[model samples]
Target: MADEITVTVVDDHPAMLVGIEQWYAAAPEPLRVAASGATSKTAWLPPGDAADVVVFDLQLAGQTTPAFGELRRLVDAGRNVIVYTMRDDEQTALTCLDLGAVTFLTKTEGADHLVSATLAAARDRPYTPPALAGALSANTSSDRPKLSIREEEVLVEWFQSESRDLVAQRLNLSPKTVTTYLDRVRLKYANAGRPARSKAALVARAIQDGLISVDDL
Candidate 1:
């Protein structure tokens, strides 16, 4: 978290673009807005493409609906995406999470949450704001990946612990074993049609499946 986390912001509103840059600049943490744009098309190029994380607005300029396509594209390209939009509905939040967003945040959550989420996303760590936690708790979808008892234990410990090596030490297992268990968990999620490649995504899946809670993180 000590390192300056680079960010790319994509929002249709000119005021929002400027506001986010100001917020990042004024934040106590090292969050630099490397690039910004009114659309995802331009944001996915150059500086934006190389940013540590991307803060995306779900509703863009010319879209009548939430920009799921843009979000999916970024996630598929292995970019860490945080959906910073005005849409606060549980379904929208869950949909973005399922699409592999690092986390979903509403603009009204303020700069603190934005800064925190950006930092966490840059490290592929989990940071659940109030809105995202509410969405996870309200989620009623029963689509959960089946996990072995060991895999489940490792996943929860990994979420609570700082690193996999710490989890291995706590469980008296090797680091490689811890990683194997985590990989299995991820495989199960992918087989269930839900991909959990990043730690934040895994945390969201764990919460939705009742394996862990926001309070645990």
Candidate 2:
């Protein structure tokens, strides 16, 4: 991480907005609050400039998009999101990660820790507080599925290729066969208590399984 890092903060509470701004203001040379907004609808992007990481609150005021949907919106906009909220349970943390959060932090942790976590996330490393770490660790275990050689080939190609048909063409197999292998992969994940129901989720699983690195995405 750089000695100076830029961040954009999204929170719904007025006090929280002030508190976070003050927190970042007091942080050491490592953290800088580049921009901040009090609502999820607040624009994160500033023309010709972008933040290194986005620290966000999951619960926004009013009836708005789902937590993960808002998270996806930030990521899809090309900002790495660090979920900092009161909803620090394992399920919420993992789900945010599933939707592509760079890391998760609880609101109760010290402001210094939040600054550190934000810095770590800016460097593409996840900083899991000990409490949330347990849940993430529990999701991957020895029972994690072992794919057959062909299945591995299909999955690897699927990860590398842009589409299923392209994967099929490259592997010289019918699209149907490719689908079958990918389906089995999903089943195996489900059997292991790891449910990857979407293509994005499967890509996350591939990263967890060492099948691909973050950069490959």
Candidate 3:
């Protein structure tokens, strides 16, 4: 609340954190780097404090699941949160959006985009990339694939080799729906030019892309 925007950066890499701090230091506005953390214990900031923006990385060393809970806490307390990470899967992106992230910036994105996203989030606006926004909006876009939540569940079960009947019973979905979901998955892979010929191949692709870990399935 000191007129200048205050930001906290959370990442497991020290060099990345320092680089981000340096970027803010050179910004035109008086940007304050409040706290930097490589772990959750060090990242926890008091609610309703001087923080105006929080740049969070989904993955941390020694932690399995992304720290969505902590990020959600910050958003619930009225702090703007930006999920900056190497992860760019649709499911993970959707999860971050659902958990109230103001922006999602992949590490592969340019530095200019990162700075722009930070500035936009500071102003309390959604700062998603145009491509990502379009992908999420155009559910029927031929270039993009869409997966229902149930389809994702089915994919996970298929990855685990769960029987169709067992998967339907477990997910409370009809067996017919499960088959439909599998067909959709095949169609998606075919569109991408890497059709999975078998259920094992599908699971391998999913795990390799960080869509769903083996333990998750």
Give the winner by lDDT.
1
TM-score of each: 0.69, 0.59, 0.58
* Tens digit per residue, CA lDDT, model 3, 109-170: 66666676787667643344533342354335355555667656676675454356887888
Comparing 2 with 3 on lDDT, the higher-scoring candidate is: 2
lDDT of 2 by residue, 51-167 (tens): 777888887767454477777777666567778888756677667765667666777766776876776566554344443443443444455456677866775666455356887
Candidate 3 positional error at 75, Å: 1.8
Work out candidate 1's RMSD over C-alphas.
9.3
- Reference-based lDDT, residue 56, model 3: 86
- For model 3 the local lDDT of residue 1 reads 48
User: Which stretches of model 3 miss by more than 4 angstroms?
Assistant: 41-43, 46-49, 134-217
Q: Which one is best on TM-score?
A: 1
All candidates' lDDT scores? Answer: 0.74, 0.63, 0.62
* Total colliding residue pairs, candidate 3: 0
Q: How many collisions between residues are there in candidate 2?
A: 0
Please list the residue runs of candidate 2 whose C-alpha ends up more than 4 Å from where it truly belongs after superposition.
Answer: 1-3, 47-49, 64-66, 138-217
